[model samples]
Target: MKDEKLLAILRLQKSKAIGDILAKKLIVNVGDVEQIFKEKSAILQNINGIGNHGLKHLFDEKNLKAAEQELNYIKNNNIKYSYFLEDDYPINLQNCIDSPILMFKDGNINFKNDKIISIVGTRNMSSYGRDFCTKIIEDLVQYNPIIVSGFAYGVDICAHKVAIKNNLQTIAVLAHGFEQIYPKVHKKYINQVNENGGFLTEFWSEEQPLRENFLKRNRIVAGISKATIIIESAEKGGSLVTADIANSYNRDVFAVPGRTTDIYSKGCNNLIKNNRATLLTSSEDIVKMLNWDIKESPKKAIQKQLFVDLNENEQKIYDLLSEKGQQLLDVISLECNIPIYQLSSILLQMEMKGITKPLPGKLFELM
Candidate 1:
């Protein structure tokens, strides 16, 4: 974290045309972040993905001035940050190809042995989603997992609050800089969040929370956790984008299944229906799926019934799964001769009955 190297990183981050992917390429090709700025434009362009459009802004005098100002703010305010190459960078985010090269963090954030899970969903929270958030955090208290979220309204703030209530570390990944809080209303929770965990962002202090900034921040939220859970969402929302990003990173995704007619639940139901996420009924689904068996003495006891009654369609699906071990939704539909439209409803009911559970990649099996 030499002053000179930090400035170069800030300058590279200011480039509009050079994204995280291209920036990392330049860093790797040049062998150092500082070397990218010192190397001639012609030599830098020789690297793959470096082009005239990008190089134009790369060395722009305006960008240099902006970086200088940002650097001054970091130094004067004693702001904390993590470089992607450094050991302190989030371990989960390091594996992602498009993770930010640098991120500013605040609060008593600790990365010691802890399970991190991001719980995100719509800003318009319903009673069901709210209750689930509270219940899940309460259930997960035994694991001492760090709850990660957007720190926005609804499910985001709900997750953070429950984490704080349960005495668990919670990280709020902001879309804007640490200089300001978005939605303005959530400012009340800032101090509490810092006390429990902290705030994280890749944006510079002067940057505003724009539409695209949120989309970009979604990756960090998705990447910086062992799993991403969607409590509820509309047919479309930022949480779904986070789920997609987590899937791309080969991370586990869990979505709370809601009734088919619930408007806000459509996105989560679709995610589970399509097999992009597992059907999350309760904390046991997470414990079982993630194999969170650390510290044997402290493990939560999950009692599952030995068997549950299954009706005709449920029995058919159950019989097929019991026979085939685990089967894709499409394969089960085809093999069991159950039409997908009807089968979807049947499977959902079966899930509620604790007869079967959905898995990532559309697979289903007896629970």
Candidate 2:
């Protein structure tokens, strides 16, 4: 919690081309980060790759001032930075060779959970891709797993939003720092996540969202999860990079299969064909792979009995909606063989009791 120690770590991380290697070196040899400044020349020379150019900047007054400014910004904004040695740091990521030495975070972080899963995929997703991601997320939320994603445009955004909608904790590991979200449009949702879950980043506040950072960020996403699920991806996509990293880390990688003709499905199909990833049809696939228990027999039976207690008419409506997902009032009346006027009142009562939810275009679905 020492401000000076935190500031020194931030300055080292901010330096380009000097990453965790130098950070670890400073921690091990210098006794403390402040000592790095005093013995700057000798320390730089001892490191293999670091040259005089890098060493010169380390002692520059301007660089120290910049680090102070960055530290001041974090303190003023109430941002939290967790170093690798900190208790709150994610243990899953601590062992990785290139793991981030520091992480800037905002909101609750639950590293103790065994159910953390990373849902990643292509930015360009089809409607099927959207539905698949949303359904699996909703199902997984029931178990209260921590959802992790990049918070990008297509699949990433869908997974985060659905987790939030279900009141589940969702974390976004950003390519940039917490000073600014990458896609400003997602700023609102990112704030919502901060209020509920949190955002994590390796870069300091002043670091821009560079392309290489994302590739580095992907490893953390993969390494921290029990499994990595790819909803959809092209043959060459960021999700595939994550899947490869997950495999290398000896974690399970699951891919949802898409049609062979689909450009997005090609990646998934290829993964399954080559045995690079297991084919995931539903949340059960992931749960089973992780050896999570399905609800016990007694609890499942109780739920079944509760489900059976619905009145005949309610059961009929539930069955119709469950099969078709959503239907307009007219469609429901026809499908359930009920009079339109009577069905209207019944649907209203069901909606009021949370038996179903209304959607746009005058559609309703079983809850």
> Which one wins on lDDT?
1
Question: Which candidate number maximizes TM-score?
Answer: 1
Cα lDDT for residue 330, candidate 1: 52
lDDT of 2 by residue, 208-250 (tens): 7899989998998997787899999998988999999998866
The ten-residue window of minimal lDDT in model 1 covers 298-307
Count clashing pairs, candidate 2.
0
lDDT of 1 at 27: 74
The lDDT, on a scale of 0 to 1, for candidate 1 is 0.86
Error of 1 at 237 (Å): 0.9
lDDT of 1 at 73: 99
* TM-score for each predicted model, relative to the true structure: 0.80, 0.75
Q: What's the count of clashing pairs in each model shown?
A: 0, 0
RMSD of each: 14.8, 20.8
How does residue 3 of candidate 2 score in lDDT?
Answer: 93
